[model samples]
Target: MSLHEQLYQWTASQGLDATSARRLRALSGVDDPPGDPWTPLRRGAGALAAGLIGFGLILWVAANWDDFGRAMRFGLLQAALAISLIAAAALRPWRAPLALAAFLTLGGLLAFFGQTYQTGADPWQLFALWAALGLPIAWASRSDLAWTPWALVVATGIGLWMETFGGHSWRFDASTVPVHAIGFVAYGLLCAGLALRPGAASQPWAWRLAVLASVIAISGTALGGLIARDVAPQFYLGLGVMGVGLVLAWRHSEVYAMSALALSVDTLLVVGLARWMSKERLDVGGYFLIALVACGLLAGSVTLILGRLRDAEARA
Candidate 1:
């Protein structure tokens, strides 16, 4: 139970009078009243307005591309970017949403510049540059509103780089093991860095994105290795990373992360079993067996997670 609930129970058990209960609450500060509920609604509205404005600008540019001159297009994008930055700087309360607007505008500007000038740069280079340039806005905003999208930009750049230039031939074999390992390591480091930041517990969206991205990457590569029957080094690395992530999440009582990691492991196991059945040329019964095993795994995972949560709450 929450501290406030515990305090209420204590006051009730003691049959405290109204003034005594008020004094106790004041002394403990555990029963402090809620803040303005409209604050969250206002923030949500601002973010939605920023997103709509960005999308509207993009749609307008697309619709008028043929009618507008090249200079007009460039001028319009630059003006929007400039206005967003100025608004972000001038309005402290709206800094987060405005910074997000500026971040999106900057990306659009970069893409337009590259397209118009034919920079001869790879797609990943554009995303990398966009992420690098937008880092200051995210830092200045100090909000998940900017950081989550920034994390997505970084993940996209990494994915494009891996696909285009990692020299892996899109196969999960010994040759691609190192590339897969490096990618997972990079994502792991990003997740760790975000999680280690001061007050990161309060601002979790960025780190959660990092974790989800890493889990998807590792799970894909590991499943590929299992299906190919090569069992590359990265497969083991992925398992190890997942194990570590699960342990850390369990210790910290992070239900989301724990659920994701567990689900990834379950998927890998189910796929591995299917592959084995295929190799063995098992009959249709094998499919039923696999289904049963999948259900069992899922049930066990849920039970363990719930049990852990209950244990943590009990300890608290």
Candidate 2:
């Protein structure tokens, strides 16, 4: 081949053929490749902005905490926390479900009990908060991940909160029983629905969520006992067992991870509060000790498996 022809052929082999280069240039006019070169800075800026907003809100709440009753202050704190976590969750790059979980779980935990801690807030106040907060949570995001557990926890928390304030009457005739019952049933149903649907409480804890529903279903009498101390103290034991099981199964699912708290509160109420009520007949050492051992082992195993699954999911 002539030297000039050889030079032209070599240029073609180098991928700088004018036609191909022209095509690439044309594509750029319409599409900007796979990613934005400036995305990281923007994301960082957004994250920083969120952090600042959250920190400022918290500081403002703290400054005003004294103006509210202990309970109201805590309630406000909870509402803020739920909103902030949700805001952060919305801004997250991935796994919005975890954020949903945070908002739902924390929102439920704080908002429900926030009333008891408040000296002045009525029983209906928390309900109002639930109605208020739950509406937005259920509405604002299309995310089931955060809201499902959020709703469930809120339901259970409210159920118990109402029962606590209602004073364990178990009159069954009182307005409290039926009102709390309907609410609990709805909350439980919502939680179960969220769990049953896809992408909410994925495996390991999926069973855990299912287990929580079962615990509630079985705790019918115990739920009553919370209001009036009507049933056997054994009710507390059952309540504790369920709490321990839930904690073992889903404690890792939460930030504060107070599966132990439920167990502690219920068991204390069962053994301590009930004891204080009158006769103080506290036996069952042998039975609960065995249950304690068995439950501890179960919780540990579930935790290990859940951690592994979370890791696997992250890797995948």
Q: lDDT per model, in order?
A: 0.85, 0.50
lDDT of 1 by residue, 164-243 (tens): 65562567667776677777777777788778875688889998998898889878778777766555666666777788
lDDT of 2 by residue, 96-137 (tens): 433443344444464546645565654555555654565454
Give model 1's TM-score versus the native structure. Answer: 0.84
Model 2 regions lying over 4 Å from their true place: 1-52, 60-124, 131-133, 138-140, 144-149, 168-184, 196-198, 201-316
Model 1: which residue pairs collide?
Answer: none
Question: Model 2: clashing residue pairs?
Answer: 71-117, 71-118, 100-146, 101-146, 104-150, 167-227, 168-227, 168-228, 169-227, 169-228
Q: Which model scores highest in lDDT?
A: 1
